[model samples]
Target: MSVSVDLATVWAFIIAFAVFVYIVMDGFDLGLGILFPLFPAKADRDVIMNSVAPVWDGNETWLVLGGGGMMAAFPLAYAVLMPALYTPVIAMLLGLVFRGVAFEFRWRTRRERNLWDIAFAGGSLVAALAQGVALGAILQGVHVEGRHYAGGWWDWLTPFSILTGVALVIGYALLGATWLVMKTEGELRERAYHLSWIFLIAMLGAMGAVSIVTPFLHVQYTQRWFAWPNIILTAPVPIAVAGVSALLLRSLAKKYDYQPFSLSLMLFALSYAGLGISLYPYIVPQSITIWQAASPEKSQLFMLFGVAVLIPLILGYTAWAYWVFRGKVNTASGFH
Candidate 1:
């Protein structure tokens, strides 16, 4: 048997896959943190923490893989994007660190647990919002002079970016709620189910908000989405998203344990696919493309060989971790 694939495309797909995995996996943990206040009960909160405890750190491994791969395979993009996104990227790292520390400290400190809980929730919110804002900035187009970001410090701060930040919060909350439903039972599960319904509405509203604003920000997307033949070709992405969203709602209403989370993941995957279609070759929205921003072909091919080996090892361990920790968490199951 023979297999043929463009090494650059292969690397691009690898990075994208890592990012998607991080979003689906760590998104739930972040969501759980975002929902900390809503749980009210200490025991319920503990269960929420424990449910994600085993996999949260491992989930973030995808972030490192994605970032490192981008730097290695698309050095030009890394050169431009990192400087453009310096502040938000730093803020995200700080928030992640704060949240990780809060996780450990809260377990140790009885009287100070509330403070740590606030830190955890706040950190998650900050990190999620920063990511969304950075994404919005990217979509709205960055100021690039040659291969570098020539934008102002506040370029990432805009009404559209802020809206995206809120939308991500709601989306993460929805993911978290569905996760709780899958990882818990009894009253906590019921509470999570109800919360998911609320998050679902918010998520829809966010999507509408983004859709309305995206076309105005980039005329190319408007043309791609609304032009005659292109419209016909792209129609299925939105239609599929709608179908998945409907299934998500139905799954939540039916109180199916795993289906809501599964459907939510599907919705995210569809949204990601639509975004990829809309962006196509562009690594930096309207500006730079993958081929242009990509590092040397020789370097990409070399890294591809390394990634080919590394990815399977990571995937194998991730799968094993999930299998070991599968099933509903309880108050007694506290983080180990």
Candidate 2:
């Protein structure tokens, strides 16, 4: 017997995977930018910047794939979402542009380095906040009228969106701190470990607050999580979160270099899985479904062939780059 799968669902998962990879890959670098203010010393800043310099540009590849895939495979959803999320989306792109420019310019000039640093941190913060707010806006549901976004411009700004924005900033900072702990040594690593602890506590609080408020936003979400046999399936996610939290704390206390970062990624994976549970089937979350938004079968099949070859090549090079740059960052050596 052969199992059958839907092409639209396949594309959905593909897009989801790309987005998740982008989050985990670029998240640490963005986190480093967020943590910059905490490390005021020039030398400390150098180490932080150097840690991500080699692969920072490459990390954004997945973002392109995810966005492009959405536009190609789900044009209707893209059309509706773009109008609804125009403000936040534009803000995110602009933030990334500033951040990228700062990343390059900071190394070129000594006198203007401080200005670049501010740009880097500010851009990362804005990008992170905008991404989270867009997510919150999606979760709260978009205003749809005959396949068009009918919501006001300011509709994306809400208390819940602000909460998620702050949560994401804290989460990214944690990723950055743990990354520093894994990639640097001596005073910097020690300082990172301390920040990791603080960020961990703050992240947990933020996660709890979001989790509590999320289910109440939509009745469907509440049912998906808390109803009957669904609870059995969903129960393990929070349990896994607790388990990972324990391991993260243990790893941090043990002073194990890579474990804290690995466990931190696991926590993120669990959170991502929880998000999938919340928003599966509905790409636009109660507005447009995966099937409803899918392009023609021929188009998806044609795209699938390209993606099949493309994804592995991306994975290969990404892995190769990381392997080449593996182990602690040397501030004196410099990546650039």
Each prediction's total of clashing residue pairs, residues at least 3 apart in sequence or on different chains, is 0, 0
In model 2, the runs with Cα more than 4 Å from the true position are 1-5, 334-336
TM-score of each: 0.96, 0.97
Ten consecutive residues with minimal summed lDDT in candidate 1? 1-10
> Candidate 2, after superposition: displacement of residue 222 in Å?
0.5
Tens digits of per-residue lDDT for model 2 on 31-108? Answer: 999999999999999999989988999999999999999999999999999998999999999989999999999999
lDDT for model 2 comes to 0.92
lDDT for each residue of candidate 1 in 1-336, tens digit (9 for 90 to 100): 112226557777999999999988899889998999998789888898889888899999999999999998878888888888888889889889999999989999999999999999999988998888888877888899877889988888889888988988898999999999998988999999999999999998898888778877778988888888898888897788889898898888889999999998887887787677777778888888877778777788788888889989999999999888888887765433
> Which residue ranges in model 1 land beyond 4 Å of their true spot?
1-5, 333-336
